[model samples]
Target: MNKKTQLGVPLSAQNRLFVPVLGASGGCGRSTTAGLLACFLAAVGSSVVLDTAPRLTSPWPSWPTEHGAGLASVPPGRPLTRHQAHAAASRSDGPAGKWSVLTDHQDWSHGPLDLPTDPAAWYQLAATGAWQAVVADTCHPVAHDIVAARTKGQRGLTAAWCALPFAVPVLCAPTSGTGVAALQTAVKAITAEGLPLQRMVVVLTATGEGRTPPVVKAAATMLESQVSAVLQMPFDPHIRVHGLSDADRLARQTVAVGSALVSAVLASAHHTWGDPLPPAPVPAVLSRTAVDSRSARPAHHEGVFT
Candidate 1:
């Protein structure tokens, strides 16, 4: 890959980007795509990954963390602060750059968490952190949501996020006959909702090591005309064996695909919002005294505001 290709969008306090990795169905490599996007985007600016999967199914809690509270640590009633949001996330630094991850860390034996279902809530939580880039590993059935929203004449999370000026949604599907069929259905549903199909990027992930399937090839050819870009994410042996604990171990091709995904998202954003994208809305700032008071409390008591 060219050196320029590896370079990511330059982000700063003045602007931020949100990339929501929307999966077509279960086991479609949504989390992996989100993680890779965060890793590459971190190369240019501060990045974070929000795992929106349920507590029991989420893999982020299993990753290493130091003094982190995970998503369960976020307060429900009040607005979140950048300090509090960062405190809740697990930080990691490596060849890919520095990034933080926030997800459910509650034990399986515990009851289900009251996670926010509205897309705006998730976007608000991300914006509170003042991050340069955010990759949300969304778990909702995007096609169903879009179709339901249309039926009810209400904007769903997928549509609402795509409507954002700074957001770029990625649809993930496996490279199989069934997956391709689901992807096509999802594309139609999104189109029906009147969302910008041209701004959406579709990622066809390889499930195993093998030649590209004919079904996937055909689907890609069909999707190229319907969406912004169709990307092929090759299977990585390291991910198959060890999961996404270490991004540095990903295959060269896999890393290149991640870089390309970032580029495509940036291109889409620029195309939609113009060359100089609109400045990011500044998050609320807390008083220095209040911040100090909050920091003085024990880490275990983070979510409980006095």
Candidate 2:
């Protein structure tokens, strides 16, 4: 058995609301989740997406940033705002809602070569005090950032823990036995470190099929005991293909999961940081061409995002 607090324990809020969509690896739909969450939050209020996952990149296009600076181009520890990263952000397409995004850049010399190497730098970025909410897609397990700090010759702080004070880590688990096993492993690892679990949300992303796998169902049920909440995001073929292109249609597809996620996030925000502004609704332009013959059709799989 793992150590955990009663469900109602308070998770100290930081200066911002950071919803980090994290998972076992690159293929677990972390990027898609982060992007969509940002969009949803933008619909309710201003939001930003920090894409630090190692392999995945956001499909949204970049808007013109102030003075043309990328993450790496900005001096480490130098204050940065969402506007500064706008050059690196994907502009919100109409009807999808407007949200700023800071993802890895194209040029090797320009943006960060990898995830934030310095924990302090990560802190600076997180503490920048921008946006009403932030959704970060992390490639590695939440614990990996601690190891990164030592490698950078920095001590005491790791990216994950540094941001924990302000973040509600959404652990995206696939609906597979391997996914369950991975979640179990991660839970155990983080528990051993004694990191608080009260703010964590276990999101089980399932593929579209006849039935949910028995093992995955069992795993999701089991996970309910270890974290704040467990959410299921059914597979949507549109997100699998378009990756959050049409927000209006996607919202309709993922209403249940989206509403649930927003509620959980707002509750978490209230607990952690006190009276954060609510997410604003951004009207989305609907597209007729988004749907095709595929069974998955057009959808948001909202839990992966919202």
lDDT of candidate 1 over 137-214, digit per residue (tens):
888888888888778987788877775548888999999988988888898888877888888889999999999999
- How accurate locally, in lDDT, is each candidate? 0.77, 0.55
Worst 10 residues of 2 by lDDT: 297-306
User: What does candidate 2's lDDT look like per residue over 1-306, in tens digits?
Assistant: 111121122222223466867675435666666766666565454577765644234443332122133344433323333344444445554233566666555553444354564333443353443355667665555545444544575442323443544667777778777777877776765675555566777777765645788998888787777777888777877666666655555645465676566567667667665664333222121122322221222222110010
RMSD of 2: 14.3
**What value does the lDDT take at residue 140 in candidate 1?**
86
Q: For all candidates, what are the clash counts? A: 0, 13
Model 1 CA deviation exceeding 4 Å by range:
1-9, 64-67, 283-306
Kindly report which residue stretches of model 2 are placed more than 4 angstroms away from their true locations once superposed.
Answer: 1-15, 54-83, 94-96, 105-115, 126-129, 143-159, 162-164, 272-306
Q: Under the 3 Å rule for N, CA and C atoms, how many clashes does model 2 have?
A: 13
- The positional error of residue 223 in candidate 1, measured at the CA in angstroms, is 1.4
lDDT of 1: 0.77
